[model samples]
Each structure stands twice: as C-alpha cells, then as structure tokens.
Target: MQIGIPKEIKNNENRVAITPAGVINLVHAGQSVAVETRAGVVAGYSDQDYIDAGAIIVDAATAWGQDMVIKVKEPLASEYQYFRPGLILYTYLHLAANRPLTEALLASRVTAIGYETMIAPDGSLPLLTPMSQVAGRMAVQLGSQFLQTQYGGKGVLLGSVPGVAKCHVVIIGGGVVGLNAAKIALGMGAQVTVLDINPKILARIDDEFEGKVQTLFSDHQNLTLAVAAADLVIGAVLIPGAVAPKLVTAAMIRNMAPGSVVVDIPIDQGGIFETTTHATTFADPVYVVDGVIHYAVANIPGAVPKTATDALTAVTIPYAAKIGKLGVTDAAKADRMIFTGVNTYAGELTEQAVAESLNLPFHSLSTRL
Candidate 1:
C-alpha cells in the first residue's frame, strides 16, 4: 500500500497527519509512504527525519498522488484538484457543515473517511478525542488572553488574587471538550460551571469535580441566565457528524458584559453561536460581537502543532496501519468502527447524519459495500 502525507495548507494548520515515528510504523508494516517536503517541518519533524524513518520525500503532487492520503485537516479548495476516483482520504472531514467539500468528494468519487465520525465499540470517538482535549484546554487559555483589556476584554484575570472575585467560566457541554475545559478553568482558580442536557453527564461531572464546579441543566432559562452572567462562556456542544445547534443567539451575546469572551469549540460543524458567520484563523482569531469577544478559530489545536501532531498521530497511527496493511474495504469490514468512519464511498454519501445535514441522499455503508 502507498500512503501519502501532504502538508496542511489551511491557515496556521501546522500539524501534519503523520509524524516520523508514524512513518516508521507504516514502513515497518511494509507500506510505502510519500511525505511532501516540509510537511512535518512545522511540527518539528524534518525531511531527513522522514527519510530516516524510510519515507520518501516528494512534492505536493506526488504526495497527493498516492493510493491513500492522510491529512490533519480537511482539504481546502486548492487541494480539491488532487481528489479523484479510487483515492482513499483519511482525515477530519466534518462534512455536515461543509457542503462544498462533501459535494466535491462525491463528485470525485473519493473514499472519504472522517476521523471525527469514527466511533469505537465503546461509543467513543478515538481519533477525535486527543485533538478535542487539546482544543478544549486551548479554549480557556485563548479566552483568558482575549479577556484582557488590551485585547478588548474586561481586564479580568482568570485566577483572581486574594480579596478579588474569581472569574466565572461557563461551559455548555459536559463531554470530552467540556470536561477538559472545566479542568483547566478550575486549575486556574476560576469558578467553573458546566451545563448539559444529559442528566447522567451532569452527574458524572459533579462526581468528577467533587462538587467544586457547578452543574446546571441546559435549559433555555438556565442558558440565558448563565450567558448573561458569564465572564467567559465556552460553547463546547457537539452532535457528532451533524451541524452544531445554534444555542447562543444574538440577543444572548448582547446581554454578555462588554469584554466578556465566548469561545466556540465546535466551529467546524457550523458553531453554537448565531454570530459565527465564518471560521477565523490564528492570524486573526477574534471579533467583537455586541461588545463581547468571539473566539471561533476552527483549528484550535493547530496553535500547538508539536503537541497536537504527536497526540493526534498516537491515536490515528493504529488505524492508519490497519488501513494500509489491508485495503480500506477489508479493514472496515473487519472493524465496524472503521466502517462508521466512511463518509463517502464510490460516489455516494454513506454517512446518514452527514447526508441528512446536507439534504443529500444517504446510502448505508452496508449497501455500498
């Protein structure tokens, strides 16, 4: 099997799909790897490092021209030219909110596997979890930076000194992202609160935090009040393979104190805020909305590419090795979790949630196979 690692062209997306160690694993599995020159440079892996790992350095076209292409983020418009029939694309496709990319994959007849959609037997998103953890921790750090008056924030420190009021950190999900965010916020000495629609999740959070963090039911009334009083509101909601529900309305933004920061973690899937018109890049990560700062960078983990790359490759390598040893079809047939990751196969949309989200026809993977 021939695998390709292309350099990420997305704005500030420094992480590469595979590290040199990952390339060594694939090579040890008797698979050929072609890494685009400088693809792993920003992530601290050099071309010589890949060569040492038995991967051949190639140009972008050569890298994209392999049997299977693995990437960190989804392909941008320019990279669309590389899509073609019989090519296997393994990456975070987030197709529910990306109609253009979804259409392009179908039109090109590419076998698209989304890391975010792959669910293990235990109902965990294995590939997406590591990056989600990084993003979740980053949300608090970024929000704190934006909360400074110099950056148009309310001049509030996350960890207040003695005799000062601690900042309020409100997270709107109790999943992996939300839990990790709460951990960071709490460690910083800020008052943390988590809201979720699932009572079990709320209970788990309460138990895990040992009652140090406040847990609230994610109802309209509770959300409204929380948003109005929140010093930092983190939108961490996710519906898995579907567009995120817009829970924060414009009116809610208006009620937030001026300089209060709101970080939307699920911006790739259309975001949880109505004011999120477009995803921001690291170059320009925030904008003022109704006197509140909105941080909606689509690739939060990309900011720490070295850590992000290593963490991401740790989980994805096992799956990639399997896919390389056997073809995608055989590997997917052997593991149902891998099959669940298949978003597009043979020119048809195979993921039901993505098809429904895009208003396209859904074809089950079983039928497609």
Candidate 2:
C-alpha cells in the first residue's frame, strides 16, 4: 500500500501528518511512504530526514493521488477535489461545525477516518491526547500573555507577589485540557477551579490534583459564579460528534471582571463560549467583548508545531503502518480501535453523528464493510 503525507496547508498549521521516523516504520512494514516536499519543514524535520527514512519525496499532486492520504487538518475547499472513491483520507475532520468538508467527503466517496475521533479500546483519544496536552498548556501561557496591558488586558500577573493574590482561572470540562491548565495555574500559584459534567472525571481531577485545584460539577449557576470571579476562563468541553454545548453565554461575559480572558479551546466543534465565532490565530489572539478578552485560537497546538508534530506522530505512525499494510477495508476491520470516525464507506456517511450533522441519511459502516 502507498501512503501519502501531504504538507499541511491550513493557516498557521505547521504540524505534518507523519514524521521521518514514522516513514521509516511504515517502510519497514513493507508499505510505501510518500512525503510531500517540505511536509515536515515547520516541524524541524528536513526533507533529507524523510528521504533518509526511505520515503520517496513527491509533489502535492502525486501525494494526493496515493492509496492513502494522511493530513494534519481538514483540507480546504480546493483540496476537497483530491478525494476519490477507494482513497483513504485520514485527518482531523471536525465536521460538526464544518459543513463543506463533510459534503465534499460525501460527494467524493472517500473512506475518511478522523484522527480526533480515533478512540482507543479504553475509550481514550490516543491521537487527540497529545494535542490536548499541548493546547491545554498553551491556554494558560496564551491567556497570561494576552492579559498584559499592552494586549488590552487587566495587566495582572498570573503569579503574584508576597501580598498580592494570584489571578483566578475557571476551566470548563476537567478533562485533558482543564487538568493541564490546572497544573500550569497551580505551578504559577494561582487559584484554579475545574468544571465538568462527568462526576467521574471530576473525581479523577480531585484525586489527581490532591486538593490543590477545585473540582466542581458543571452547572450554569456554578459556571456563572466561577466565570464572574475568574481572571481567566478556559472553555474545554467536547461532545464527540455533536456541536459543543454552549456552556458560557454572552451575557456571562458581561458579568466577568474587566480584562478577564476566555480561551475557547473547543472552537472546532462550535465553541463552548458564545463569543467564539471561528478560530483565531496566535498573532492576534485577544478580542474585547463587553470589556473582557477572548483567546479562541482553535489550533493552539499549532503554535508549537515541533512538539505537537512529534507527539502526534508518535501514536499516528503505528496506526498509519497498520492502515498502509492492511489497506483501508482490512485495516478498518482489523483495527477496531482506530475506526471511530468512519464517516463514509463505499459512498455513504456511515457515522451517525456525521450524518446527523449534515442532515444526511445514516448508513452503518458495519453492513457495508
């Protein structure tokens, strides 16, 4: 099987689908690996590195025409035409808020697997975890930086002096992003409270933090109170194939302190905060809303491409090798764990959530497979 790694063309998305070592692994598994010229450039991997790993260097046109085309982000409108029947296009297809991409995949009849939805047998996101870790840590740092007076913030420091109190951070969803934000805020000696709908996840947070960070059952009332008092609010809720439940209202932002920040990390699935329209960039992260700042960089992990690239490829490569060796049909059957987001089969939206999102008829991939 021939696998292609296309250079990520998403704005500010510097991370590639696979790495040099990943190519070597695929090659050793008796699969052909093709790396688009400079695919790993921003990730600090030279073209020579991929070539050294036994991957053939190719141009965009040829790479897109391979048996399997793995990408880091959802393809743009122009790239949608690259999809064809029997082609495996694996990437982060955040199709809930995205209608065009879903339509294209359906029209092209490509067998698509979403990296973010590829859950492990244990119900954990092996592929998405690395990005969650990076984005979570970045939320705090970005929030802190954006809080500067120059950046139109309150000019308060995250870590305070002897008598001064540290800023408060209210993190929604005590999953990976919330926990990571809590860790960073704790390290900075700031007050942190994490809110989540799942009591089990809240319990896990309580145990992990050992009473350092506050874990509360997420509710509108509790969330409003926390947001009003917080200097920074991180929106990290996720509902697999559904639009992100709006946890923070626009009116809620008005209640918050002036210059307080809201980082909506789940902007891809329609953000948890009402103010989030679409993804923002690291270049200009903050936008004033009712005297509060909003840091909604949907692709926060891309800011640190090198780290995100390495972490993502660590888990992605092994699976890529499996898909490359077994082919999409056999790979989907053999690798149950990696088949979480099978949106289309021979020519159907097999995933119910994706079908519902696009208002298309649902067809289970099981029958087709």
TM-score of every model versus the real structure: 0.99, 0.97
TM-score, candidate 2, is 0.97
- Cα lDDT of all candidates, in order? 0.94, 0.85
Model 2 CA lDDT for position 272: 92
In model 2, which runs have C-alpha deviations exceeding 4 angstroms?
none
Model 2, span 1-369: residue lDDT tens: 888989988778889888888888888999998889998998999999998999989999889999999888888888987888889888888887888888788888888888877777888888888888888888999888878888888999998778998899889988788888889988888889999989999989889989888888898899889999999999888777767888899988899989888899999888998887777776676678899988877788888889998898898888878888777777888887656757667777777776776687888877877
Cα lDDT tens digits for candidate 1, 57-163 = 99999999999999999999999999999999999999999999999999999999999999988888989999999999999999999999899999999989999
Q: What is the lDDT of candidate 2?
A: 0.85
In model 1, where is the ten-residue run with the lowest total lDDT? Answer: 360-369
Q: What are the clash counts of all predictions, listed in order? A: 0, 0
